[model samples]
Every structure is written in structure tokens, then in C-alpha cells.
Target: MIKVVKFGGSSLASAEQFKKVGDIIRKDETRRYVIPSAPGKRTPKDTKVTDMLYHCYGQAILANDDDDCEEYQRSFEDLIEKIKERYQEIIEGLSLELSLDEDFKVIKENFSKKIGRDYAASRGEYLNGKIMAAYLGIEFIDAAEIIFFDEEGNFDDKKTDEAVAKRLENLERAVIPGFYGSGPDGKIRTFSRGGSDITGSIVAKAVHADMYENWTDVSGFLIADPRIIPNPKAIDVITYRELRELSYMGATVLHEDAIFPVRKEGIPINIRNTNSPEDKGTLIVEDTCRKPRFIITGIAGKKDFASITVEKAMMNGQIGFCKKVLEVFEDNGISIEHMPSGIDTMTIFVHQDEFEEKEQKVIAGIHRAVEPDFLELESDLALIAVVGRGMRATRGTSGRLFSALAHANVNVKMIDQGSSELNIIIGVRNHDFQPAIKAIYDIFVNTMI
Candidate 1:
């Protein structure tokens, strides 16, 4: 049983952290393929290596266009020295006989060559991977060599899967740096922030690993945000659909799109805490027959949403009415989050930021499309998702949610549930977001405990 372990920035921030990771990997021989992120913040006040790279590259760009670029050049040089010092500190701390002098020279020259910001940012992972490979005494495989991107910059899954599978099929152990694959031009291209998770998932799919272990700072996801609900219960097991629901509502433990690859192959992902390996953490699977511990698995919510309600007589019987309404949003380049309807009324929920910019255009488009008898727009709304697999089997889950809110004196604005009964979405006022989450947590977790 092979396990592809990916350590986040915090887990590989320093020599001490690297030692911990080394021990974790060495203790289990099956932990073969390793993915490493660049060094993250060593302290609360420190900046991430990736962010520093971006800033440094920003100075480099300014230096190229400006007539008086001495200051910008100096600033870029200082950041480069700082970054090199960080790696040197880690190398010395580990007492490794590795020399990064040549790599640093190449990086400095590449910056002068204007190799693009992707190349600049990717060097963090590249350099860190080298350090980790040397420390672990394993073969280092650059992500650029295996993870391929198309000419359009979109990831080429077929190309990447074939490349990674073929390359690692015979190798017993290796370290693959996360983030930044090779583009069609053979230049570096990076995924969005928290992309190492994507790299790890891709590797897991490539190897058909039994499990993918993601090590981060937190132990696992809690039923509610800790800031809102103190000491919230940890989720032991969650389905991919449930996690996606919560992630959309703002739970945010892993990258939103990272679930796709491993999910396709039916691989379970274990979100483990590097600081506390003894903890069971959270397991996210595609599907499960195990019963949930409570009627709801988790509660997550986001604020600043606006809902557009359109009412027309006999709307349910009217063909293409809903489609016409959706077309207005699609035409305006806005995405609808949820659309819940009644016999004669239909409501569309969207992010307030997206809607506020094109409100008049969207309203005019909707008016031209449906010509509704009544139209209303509600803003500053928050949608909370009460999600669980057990919700389908248990009755009164909605009742309990409403009761909890009512007791907390938080008025509910709208409620919608999917047919699968896996999640119930409740819309409330923005001011009541925290209170409503606390009330729901109290009903689902505190009372049970």
C-alpha cells in the first residue's frame, strides 16, 4: 500500500520542521512519493516565501521599465539575499553537505533574463525540493518534468497522468516538488494559491495510491469555524460531496478544486496534523456506508450575498421561464450559486460582489427575459449550509436548525434543501451570521456532548 504524502509550507518551514517530516516519512516505508511546498511563515509575523517571491519579481518588472531602477534593483537584490539566507540557515541547521551556491547563481541569472513570474515563484518549491531530497537521500523529480500543461495553460490531465505514471512506475521512492508544472513552451506555470494540494492529488491519481496524506498545521476540519464556535467538534470522516458543500460555504481546509483527481480514482484523502501525528484527523472519501455521528456533519456559511426574487403567475407551468432567467445571469458573466423556486416564484442567489457591479444590467436583462409581475432584490444576506449524510435518514433536522435559530433570535430569510437531503441551505441576515452558526453548533454538538 503506497501513500503519497504532501507537506504544506508550515510543515517544511525550517530545519526543525524538516526533521519532524523526515521522521514521519522514515517511520513508514510505504510513504514513498513526497511532495513539498516552499517554506512558509516561521512565525506569525513572518511572510511566506511565495509571497516574497512575488514581491521580488514585482521589483524586477519595475526595474526593467523604469529609467532610474537602482532602488528597485537594490530591493530585488535584498529579497534575493534574504531568500538565500533562509535556505542557507536551514541547510546549516540540518548539517547537510549540500551546496545551493550554483542553484542560487542560476536563479539570479534567470531573474535578469526575465523568465516570467511563474518561474520566479516556482523557484521556492524547486529549491525546497532540492533541500528536502538531499536531506532525505531520495531521487528528486522536478514537477515540471512530469506535470504538463497545454498551450492554453489549462492542465493536460491525460499528458500528466501518463507522464507521472510512467516515470514513477519503476521507481521505489522519490520526491516530487509541488506546484508549477511545465507549460507547452517548456516554461513554468503555476496553479492558484494552495496549489500544492492539487499537485499532491495529481500524484496520488498517477500512482493509484491507497491513500493521500495532506499534512498541515491544523488537525482537521471542525464542524464550525473555531473563531465562531469555540472548541468545535472535529469531523472524523466526510464525503467528497459534503466537503465540497462546506468548502463552498467557506470551511476552506483544502484547495476547492483539489478533490477532483483523487476523487475520480476513489482514493481517500487523510487530512493529518504534522504537529500532532497521534491524532486521527479527518478522512475524506468519495462515498461511505458508515453512519455520521450526528444528524449534521458540519455547518459553514458565507456572508455578503444578494438574492433576486422573480414572481410570475403560473411560472411552474411556463416552459423555458427558468432557463430565460438563468440566461440573463450567464449573459452578464455572473454565476448563480443557487436557484430555489415555488409555484409562482423563483429566487436566484449570487455573490454580492459579483452582483453589485452588474446589478442594473442583470435586472434589465431579467426584466426583458421573464417580465415578472413582481421583482425584488435582497442584499447583505448570508447562506449557511447544514450538511451531513445522516440528514437523509433522520427527520426533524430542518426543524432542529430552525428551532436553534429562533431560540437565538436570529431571523431566517430563506431556506433551501437539495433532493439528496445531504445539505440544507439557510439564508440569514449578514449581522446574524456568527450567532446563527453558534446556535446551530449548540443544537448539533453541545447538546449531544
Candidate 2:
């Protein structure tokens, strides 16, 4: 059995964290492929290495200007020196013979040449992977050598799979840096932030591993935001569709994009904690017959939404009326999140931040297109999604949800549910968001007795 494990920045933030990660990997023989992220914060006030690199590179770019070239050059060099010192400290703490002198030399040269920001940001993961491999006595495999991107900047899945599969098949064990791949021109390109998770998923797919383990600071995903529902239970198992729904509403532990790669290959991801490896954490799978502990799997919500409500007589009989209304939003570059309609009324929910500037133009366009009898715009809305597969089997879930909200005295602004019965989205005033989530959790979880 083979397992591919990826450690987040928090898991390898310091020498102490590195030692913990090493022990976790060594304790399990099946963990043959490892992925390491850049160093993160040692304390709440500490900065991430990737953020530092970005800031330093910003200074390097400014150094090209002749007006203050000397000042910017010194500033950039100071940041570089700090980076080097931090790595040296980690090396000393681990008592590793490896010296990063040549690595630092190459970085200095790259900064002088201004290779690119992607190259600069990726150096964190690259250098960390080197240290991890050396400390573990395993081979170091660079992600750029395997993961490929096309000239258009799209990930080349077919090309990457062949390259990565063939390469890892020949190796017994290896550590590959996360978050970056090589472009068609052989220049480095990076995924979006939290991309190390994506890299781990790609590696797991390439190796066809039995399971992919993601080690991070959190034990797992909670049923609701702990700040809202104190000591919420951890989700034992969640399906890919359910996870996507919750992530959309704001429960973000794993990068949402990370699910696609291993999901297609039918590989389950185990979200584990580096600090407490004994906990089972959360298990994400494509499909499962396993029963959920509660009628609702999880609750997540997002704020700052505005809804446009349009009412017209005989709207149900008027075909294409909704399409015309939606086209106005599309033309204005605003996307709709949810649309709950009655026989004569329809409300379009959109992000307030996106709709605020163009509200007048969009309203005018809708007036010309749909010619509704009455139109109203409301902002400062929050949407909460209660998602679960078990919801389909459980009757009166909606009734119970409304009951909980009424008890909490939070008014419901809107309600929508998919035909699949996988989720129910409730809209409330921004002030009532947290209380609504807590109320729902209590009815389903706390009051279970």
C-alpha cells in the first residue's frame, strides 16, 4: 500500500514542527511520497516565508529604478539575509550537516536578474523541500520537474500524469515541494494561494495512492464555526459534493480546487493534525454509504450579499422573463449566487461588494428588460447553507430548521433548496448570521437528547 502525505506550512513552521512531521512520516511505512510547504508563522505575530519573499521581491523590483536604487537594494538584501538566517537556525536545531550556501547563492543571483515573482515565491517551498528530504534521508524530487503547465497557463493534466507517474514509479521514496509547476517555456508558475493542497492532490492522483493525507494545524473541519458554536463536533466523513457546498458558504479547511484531482481517481483524503496525530480528523470521499451522525452534516455562512427582488403579475406563465433578468446581471459582470422565486416574484442574490458600484446601471437595465411592476433592492444579507446527504432521508428537516431560528428570534429573509435535497440555504440579516448558525446546531446537535 502506498500513501502520499502533504504537510502545510504550519506543520513545518519551526525545527520543533519539522521533528514532529518527520516522526509522523517515519511511523508509517506506507507514506512513500511526501510534499512539504514553506515555513509559516512560529507565533501569531510572525510572518509567513512566502509573504516575506513577496515583500522582498517587491523591493527588488523597485531597486531597478535609478532614483533610489541603493536604498531599495539594501532593503532587499536585508530581507534576503533574514530569510537565510531563519533557515540556518532550523538547520542548526535539527543538527543537519547540509549547508544552504549554494541555495542562497542561486537565490541572490535570481534576484539580481529579476527572474519573476513566481520564481521568487516558489523558492520557499523549494528550499523547505530540500531541508525536509535531507533531514529524512529521502530523495528530493522537485515539483517543477514533473507538474506541467501549458503556454496558455492552463494545467496540462495528461502531460503531468504521464511525467509524474513514470518518474515516481522508479523511486522508492521522495519529497516533492508543493505549489509550483513548470510552464511551457520552463519558467516556474504557481497555483493560487493555499496551493500546496492542490499540489498534494495532484501528486496523489499521479501515484494512484491508496489514500492522501493532508496534515495541517486544525484537527479537522467542525460542524460549524467554533467562534459561533463553541466546541462544535468534528465531521467524521463528508462527500465531495457536500464539502463543496459547505466551502461555498465559508467552511474552508482544504482548498476547494484540491478535491478535483483525487476525486476523479476515487481517492479519499484524510485531513489530519500534525500536532495531534492520534485524532482521526475528517475523511473526504467521492461517495459513501456510511451514515452521518446528524441530520445535517455542517453549517457555513457568508455575509455582505444584496438581493434584487422583482415582482410581476402572471410571471409564472411568462417564459424567458427570468432569463432576461439574469442577462442584465451577466452584462453588468455580476454573478448570481441564489435565486428563490415565488409564483409572481423572483429575488436575485449577489455579492454586495460587486453589485454596489454598478447597482444603478443594473437596475436600469433590468427595468428596461423585465419591466416589473415593483422592484426593491436590499443589502447586508448573510446566507447560511445546511448541507448533508442524510438530509434526503430525514423528513421535516426544514421544519426543524425554522423552529430553531424562531426560538433564536432571528428573522429569515429568504430560503432556497436544491431539488436534490442535499442542502438548504437560509438568508438572514447580517447581525443574525452567527446566532442563526448556533440555533440550528443546537436543534440538531445540542438538543439531540
Candidate 3:
């Protein structure tokens, strides 16, 4: 069985880390295609190679106009040397007869020309891929050749898939840099940060691999943010839909968009840790017949939300009432997060930062469109999503949730559950966010255990 493995920056941070990765790959002959990210922070205080590239590029941009151009040039040279040293250290540690001199010369020339930040950011993965390929004695395939983007800078999925499939079909093993592709103009373009995950998924789909293994610093995704819930339980297996709910609510391990490409092909993604290869990490699949271990799969939440409540007698009776109110938000370009309603009241939840600038306009639009008798706007609200497929089979999940919060003296402002019974959302005051999560976790995860 063929496997496509993608290693995150932390997994390839240092030569020591690279040694660990090399062992993992060598042990698994089926792992033919490799995707790698730039070197990440080796320690808590260390800077990432990507960030250093950005800084160096930024310095190059400013050197053109600086009064002390000579000094600025010297600084730029220093930064480039540091980046080379990072790669050189890895090469020396791995005992590889590889030289990145020509690559660095080209990169320095590009930086001098101010060839866009995307190009600057992409060099991290590009350079790392070269090192990875040499260390493994495998062919190096530049992602720009296989991944395609449209003129608008959006990924061209069909083109990318077609190109990647044809390119890798004949190759037994290759290393493709993650996070970058070529646009219509043949200029380098990058995805948002942490896009290596998306690259892995794309390669997995193109190759139709049996499984996609994502190697990172963490063994797997945790039930809750470890910072919020001390030593949170690790999720062994999660479905695509369930992961979406948790990711949307703020549980981040895998990139949310990464699930799409593999999901369409019904490919399963195994999130593994490089440091602890023996431990089986979280498995993300399209669907599963296996029952969840807990009543709820995971809980995640976000803070700084504002709710606008439109109350009018017989409001539910009026046709297009909700539509008109929603249109007002749509017209104002504010994306509504949630809209839970009663017979006479509808509360529109939105990110506070997005709504603040156009608050008066939206309020006025609501007044003219819906003509509610009372309109109240509240802010500093936090939304928590308790998601699980098991909740559908088990009863009193909501009762237990509310009971836990009440016992913790946390007041719930709003509650919304999807028709799928897959997840429940509860809004609480910003201050209660941590406590609310703790209470929910204790009830759903701890009590169940």
C-alpha cells in the first residue's frame, strides 16, 4: 500500500529532528511521496525559518530607500547568511554531500529584486524539500510545477490534480515542497499559514494513496485545547464532519481546508507525531461505522462575538421577516455566525470585530426591513461547540451540558444545535469561556469515563 506522508516544520526543525524523520520514512517503504514544510522553531524562543525569510525579504525591500543603504545591505547579507547556516547545519549533521550555494545565489537575487512576499515565503519549503530529497537520496519535485493557481490567486484544483497525478505516476519516491504553487503568471503563490496540511491532502488525492500521514510535533489532536483543559485527552479517531465542527469552534490540529481534497476521494488522514512514531495518533476519515468512545467527540469555542436580538410580537408569523433581517447583514457584508430565534425574537450572532464598524448601518437596515418592536445588541459573547456523532444515540446530552454549566455558575446566553444532532453550540459571556469549557468537558468526557 502506498502512503503519502507530509512532515510539518517542527518535524524537520533541526538536523536531530531530520534524523528522526529519516528513520520513520526508511522504516516504511510504502511511504513513497514526501511533502515537507520549512524549518520551524527548534525551541520556544527560536524563530521559524519562514519568519526569518519574511524579515530578510522585508529588509531587502526597505534597503532600496533607506538613508544608510550600505548598512541596510550589510544587515540583509547577515540575515541571508543565517538562513544558509540553518540549512548548512542540517546538511552537516545529516552527513550529506549537498551544497545550496546556487540556490542561495538565486534566492539572494530574487530578494534583491523584491520578487513579492509569496516568493519569499515559499523559499522555506522549497529549500527544505531540496535538503529532504538529498538526505533521502530521492528525486526532488518542485511543487510549483505540479500545483496550479488561477489568476485570482485561488487554487485551481482540477489543473493541480491532473498535473500532480501525471508527474508522480512514474516516480517511485519524490519530495515535493508544501505551501506553494504557481499562479497563472507563473509567479509563486502561497496559501495562508499552516497550508502544508492542504498540500499533503492534495498529494494524497492525486496519488490515490491508501492513507495520508501528517507528521507533526504533537502525537494527535486533543479533545480540548491543552492550555484550557490540562492534559486533555487525545482524539483517537474523528470523522470529517465532526472535525469541521471542532475546527470551526477553534480546536486546531489539522488545517480545516485540508480535509476537503482527501474527503472527496474517501482517503483517510493519519495525524502522527515524528517524536513518538510508535504511538498511533488521530485518524481522520470521511465516515466510520465505529462508535465514538465518548458521548461528545470534542468541544471548541471562540470569543469576542456580538449578538443582535430583534423582538417583535408575532414575528415568526410574518413571512420573509427573517430573510429581510438576514439580507440586511448580507448587504452590509457581515457574515452571520448563528441566528437562533423564538416566536417573537431572533438573535443574530457575529464576530464583534466584523460587526463593530457597520453596527449603525446594520441596525438601521434591520429597523427598516423587519420593524421589530424591540431590538437589543449585546457584545463580548463567546460561542462554544460541543460536537459528537454519539450525541445522536445518547439522550439528555443537553441536559447534562446545562447542568454542568449551572453548577459552575456559568450562565448560558444562547444555545443552538444542528439538525444533524452532530453538535450543539452554546454562547456564554467572554469571562466564562474557560470555565464553561471545563464544565462541559468534565460532564461529557470525565463523567462518561
Error of 3 at 118 (Å): 0.5
Shift of residue 448 alpha carbon in model 2, Å = 1.7
Per-residue lDDT tens digits for candidate 2, residues 57-82, read 88888886554569999998999999
> How accurate locally is residue 376 in candidate 1, as Cα lDDT from 0 to 100?
98
Whole-model alpha-carbon lDDT for candidate 3: 0.94
In candidate 3, position 174 carries an lDDT of: 97
Give the TM-score of each candidate: 0.98, 0.98, 0.98
**What tens digits encode model 1's per-residue C-alpha lDDT throughout 50-147?**
99988888887777778487998899889989999999999999999999999988887788778898899999999999999999999999999999
The CA lDDT of each predicted structure is 0.93, 0.93, 0.94
Which portions of model 1 miss their true places by more than 4 Å? none
lDDT of 1 at 46: 89
Per-residue lDDT over 194-215 for candidate 3, one digit per residue giving the tens place of the 0 to 100 score: 9999999999999999999999
lDDT score of residue 397 within candidate 3: 89
